[model samples]
Target: MALFVQPWPIFLSINYLGLQACFLRVFMKIKLNNVCIFPLAQILNCVVYCIFVAMAAGLPFLNPYKSTDDADFRHGVNFAVAGSTALPTEILASENILSPVTNSSLSVQLGWMSTHFNSTCKTRGGWCVNQIKYLSFFLKQSTYCVEKLKNSLFMVGEIGGNDYNYALLPGKSIEEVKKIVPNVVEAIKNAVRRVIHYGAVRVIVPGNFPIGCFPIYLTRFQTNDTAVYDEDQCLKELNDFSKYHNDNLRRAIKDLKNEFPNVVIVLFTIILIFCFVMLYTGFDVMSLQKACCGIGGNYNFSLTRMCGAGLPVCSNPNQHISWDGVHLTQEAYKFMTGWLIRNMLHKLQCSV
Candidate 1:
């Protein structure tokens, strides 16, 4: 907990300095074609520029576009890894999906990435190397990314919930979990700042959605006592934590708005986002937190038991609430994304 406290201005300064160094060298060489007295100095600068950029940015992820099945605004991207609350990048990557970066959950993975340019981290030795082929792929496109940082197509970040769950791992109490709320909020702020540092302006920072309702939490934390599950389908305590995170997030966004007057940071809460869906298209909101598709027992949904391997899926997955225990079905994502597109465009006042 103390590790993260007051990391912002310092880390942000280090990050900015790194970016500035890269920008100056790269731009200076581009401008001074053959004018320089020493060509060797330019080459040395180029090598240093790349090393820092790679250190600051873990290899870039493939940019995912909006699902093509829907016809509008197909260029959006989602950085939010499922089952991650700014879930440590390492944990998400452990599942073989995400590459652990600054806000990652996997400590080992984060350490590996930090080892690249930092001398302190280098003593750890051989930490940040991924497959050679992956490294080469990123190197080829690294320069182009800096140029494209402005005018980000779309930004999505949902981070820091897993940290609270981690707090629960070592004999923590409700009071302890409550204490983590502030830190989680700050983590989200840091993550948003990092993305902005990389050049995302029109961003959507989603709130924690119903972690208490997760089937794994319910089954693992269950007591013989009947007071655990609430009628709307989640442990009240977990949902309360979710509510607190979202509330503080709203405040953070307000503060950010004060800080950056021109950018758009929409505080898209799940329910408010859901309400826009219900009103415009009239999607039924039954069991909004319950699994519509999962392999777990009646109410709990999870990947442990996949909903349908080869068998038939729900006839109307859109209408059903839970998709898998941990995620909503593709159909559900469609409606939600559609609603989001409308609201975001409305806020930006731009037509797709």
Candidate 2:
């Protein structure tokens, strides 16, 4: 059920706000520099993890794994690119879905991981042969990359959301988007397999969030029929689609566990956490499906005048769950992160 492990270094391959919450929990546990030091823009863009890791390690914050720079891998490296998907560009394109943001998919992130290892380790015949000299002082000497990675935690996802986002936002029917779940899960499975092969003893692969509960989807898919909405006012069809994705992903993770009994693969139920927060009395239920930073519409969301485009932000973002139309606010993330840590720390088999 859990992998009893030490305080291992974290190697992140993530995307989206759900996994960002988990990273924030780790950052806080490590007692890193105040997260406020990094701009919110950078945090939303998935570029703050390495900076926090670097800062925690007492290293220069400026050299936190930029593509052009030599990344200091003393603590960890983040391979998450915001707006990246689990599915490849070509696959999405074939479905007539276009990725408007960066083309860094799960495969691209894995490629970056490979490149990082290649630079850090001594390789022979394209395989890491000896312990990395620079990392030797920090980590125990291991002959191969796999051995080195055993002491690392791999946060594989909360990816594939953008795949759905790209598809759904472009007017693809829920049924059509539902078909994308298999390929997306397969892509994630392949990524997990690769990380396990690279010697990841513990891996946390999170599922999709309840997108129907978000302001973006609510605004976009508003219907006249009250029957289509749930008790929480979320679109029933969209929430079911999210469940469909999570179910498929859960099955994939089970298969991976069977294949690699030695590895600890965790399926972080992000939707369940969202549900808990929604049901809790403390959360501002009135604004549960509204954007904290946006303008117009019933859900305070507008595709034309999106958040961070100098629109009128709410006076207190802490009172709202949704940050923009899509993402969660910092307070929402903080609360979710706290819940996640309490629930997952035992499963992760790690101490504070």
Candidate 3:
């Protein structure tokens, strides 16, 4: 039951913190309406989540890779836009951009990388360019170059959650997210298509993680009344909305595959992502509603409390699923990568 992240240690001061109060005031009203019909709404929400997750579960990328090793592991790179959608690269320059890649964005498996690699190390003109950069640098390196290392490359072109967030940006509704999500998914699809245009043989088109489940969203939408649809848990409404997005994305994959049969296209399933998050937040059995890396009390999640110069760290890091309420802890990332290896690696071939 790694679905609940409990004892969400959010700080009380979050209401007064930057952006928190404004988002809460706006989103809470929305949640109040949605949560009022909670049970019925939640059921529908679960159904929608199930549809996409079921589809994702069937993907070849979701297959196991426990037996695979690093030597045969060709090269692996996480070329995701921290909060990107499947769209044009120039969009990053916009003032509205959230998960910016160039001067912003960029993410990591944190402790998973042995070296203290920079987060936005992959200069983001775009996710595709970033991968090509990785492919380029890898080939020019001495100890290990892309040419010598990559017998087969498993490029996880994407897994964008922030677009869904963009859809939720104050001015919009979940339905709006539904409308915009396909565009984002298409942007991702197009990215993969471009990769194939290059020499990448085996490519993985991972859809978004559960946006409904992110701690940040919950913190913003929570209400005193249980009636409204609590988006924090990623109830039926958000999941169903996201499902529609994935459904369209899956069909896009089919369309792309049919168009380019020679190139291998694997879709990363959400089960692994969900399971990974569950394991990280310990939500499978607990609620990581707040962040262990932050300070203060429950507001779901607040940057004021998250890890950095200002926040506090937990004595037992493993027990806390989120190092930052918005991101996963190193232990959580390790568990997720293990899940990925089990669920994706072998199918992409490369042996590991």
Candidate 4:
């Protein structure tokens, strides 16, 4: 839902030429460069040096890349990985999820940029680009990457939520935030249009997650009035607002699909999967409400003291959906990914 990370761990598992494959080639060129630019730059540099030393001693990046040419008789075979970070579990997850289909085959071509609405191109001041203006910038920088993938998938968003959050977090009412929905949807439509112009054929645009379920929202909007709460203890009105955005977004995608007849635009359905996961994993309202990693108040979230050194982490992260107030845990992301692969693969047109 607007989970901001250091960008090094960002990866999207996608299908290419009707086969399960890794898409890390796009990051390979910048692999060394990212080590210097990311937040843990110094630590990564030390690790990079060690890798170079090991490589110099004859450890190759691709020890043995493998694939098969034989066509299957019945079902389609897909690939994926899970978990996080640099440890064995996380490394294995990254390796499986981000691995390429074949050694000789080129990796998926894609690019991404993380920034806010006012900064992307909305109301440009001096050197800054707003959300609307970011399209031109994206097109200029991403032509080569887009061109390389003859059959490409463009992920337009989990955006606009931040824009709404910008409005709401500063004490705006739900009605006021609702009024700005059109502007947000329009920006997304414009983004999809630009991507189509630059040759994206399949795009999977995700709607916002249930913002009402966020710990930040829960804590901020808390009231003694139990009537205002949902069964999950999230603010009912806020979740309704998120649903409003999804409704308009689906409508926009439908119109866009009709105009660009060849492009396959799908709205990623996240809410249903989230609800299903919570139930499937046996988490109740109390278990789901608090942050898995944080300190202080009822939601275990603080505006000043976030989850970091000296903060308390929950005994079991697997029981919690959120890692902190505003973000999901690695376990939660893994569950969602697996669920998406199983359910949305057909809708995404990745399965035959």
**Which candidate has the top score in lDDT?**
2
Selected candidate, larger TM-score, 1 vs 4: 4
lDDT of 1 by residue, 122-168 (tens): 21223353535455545545534433333333233345655555555
Find the candidate with the highest TM-score and give its number. 2
Predicted candidate 3 versus true structure: per-residue lDDT over 18-120, tens digit per residue? 1111111211121111121113221121111211221222211111111233321111222222333344334522524454432212112211221211221
Provide C-alpha RMSD values for all models, in order: 16.1, 5.8, 16.4, 15.9
Arranged by TM-score with the best first, the candidates are 2, 4, 3, 1
Error of 4 at 98 (Å): 36
- Residue 242 alpha-carbon offset, candidate 2, angstroms: 0.3
TM-score of 1: 0.54
lDDT of 4 by residue, 1-352 (tens): 1111000111111111211231222221222321222233211211221122112222222110112444221111111111111112222233232312221111111122222111232323334455456757655545433443324344454556655665577677888768768866776676666546645566666677788888888888889999889886778998899999989999999999999987777777667677776668665457686887687778888767767667777786657777777766545655565554445446646533
**TM-score per candidate:** 0.54, 0.82, 0.57, 0.61
Which ten-residue region of model 3 has the weakest summed lDDT? 1-10
For residues 1-352, could you state the per-residue lDDT of candidate 2 as single tens digits? 0011112233334311112113333445654222354445522422232333333323343322344666545545566666788887998999999998878787887876666666665444322324444455334333644454655566677788899999998799999888888999998899888867766777878788899898888888888999999998999898899999999999999999999988878888889988887778376877888887788889999877787756777786667778787877666665565665566656756554
Scored against the true structure, residue 15 in model 4 reaches a CA lDDT of 19
User: Which residue segments of model 1 deviate by more than 4 Å?
Assistant: 1-103, 106-149, 165-172, 217-233, 274-293, 300-316, 349-352
* Clash-forming residue pairs, model 2: none
Q: Model 4 — which ten-residue stretch has the worst lDDT?
A: 2-11
